[model samples]
Target: MKPLKEVAMSYMALSEAQKKLEEGAFGEAAGESSKAMEFSKTMPPGETFDHDGFDALCYAVLASARAGLGEYDACLEASGRALHYFNRRGELQQDEGKQWIAVVFSRGVAFHETGVYDEALKNLNMAGEMITERKGELPGKEAMLKEIERRKSMLLEEEKSQRKPGYKAWWEFWS
Candidate 1:
């Protein structure tokens, strides 16, 4: 078994990597996140994610990191693994449910960012329905439904634009 301090250090490393990712340092963040994942395998589960959730979080971040690195399909597959792992936890477990919603939304956002509208819409709508059904009961669920709606609107516009003669890249302004 790994020492408690070692596990804590690894947890901090993953958090730092996520911060770097949010700050747009993709390469460094990916490396750090990978290291964090490897380190986490040695530790026992405490809270938040059971041992499995910890693994899923590791893989999910890896997938998001891959998305940031412009590998969309890999991101979707990896994020799917995360969602599956979360879903297997328990239907009554809102914590895991929340985690699934997050991965779904994140993957949807990533896919949409990379111009995969169909897949993005499917996942976004899935998340919206889940949140809508459990809005009052779920904890820490701020702005998720609204964000899903916003993404859906953007997707609808993109779909419209795709039918026109002059379709624009997803990253560009579409007005």
Candidate 2:
């Protein structure tokens, strides 16, 4: 079994990766996230290997880095993995909805970039609702709320553009 010190170091690495991801340093974030994941693998099986929140953190960082790199599919995969981990521990609604925020946001971004507008809007709205419900209790609450509003606005614009009238029906063209 790996020592608790090693687990602590892994979390530190994950934190660095998340910072790098937020800074738009995709390559550096991926490297740091990989190191954290590798360290997590060194722990012994059973209770000693319980990952607290490190697994979700690493996956969230990975997803954000991949999204920054324009790897939307990979970002979605990583975000899904993070969501899976959170779901397993029933932490999706824990911590005042903080735990699932990053994962949900990443999934929303990935879906948006991939042209999956419905899914994007759904996930983004979920994140927005969580942010709204948890308001003052969440760290960076204002920033998160602003971002959610921005994305929702963007999605609405895109939806409106798609619905704009222009083309004629086949029968009308024949007429």
Write one digit per residue (lDDT tens) for candidate 1, span 45-119: 553335566667666666767777887777787787787777666343454465466567778887898888898
Choose the strongest candidate by TM-score.
2
Candidate 1 worst ten-residue window by lDDT: 90-99
lDDT of 2 by residue, 1-175 (tens): 4468778778889888978876879989978998998888777665366574677778877887887788899999988988877766645446614647867887898898899999999999988876766544666667767877898899999988886497666898799
- Least well predicted 10-residue stretch by lDDT in candidate 2: 90-99
TM-score of 2: 0.78
**Reference-based TM-score of each model:** 0.63, 0.78
Model 2 misplacement above 4 A: 88-99, 135-139, 164-175
lDDT scores in order: 0.72, 0.79
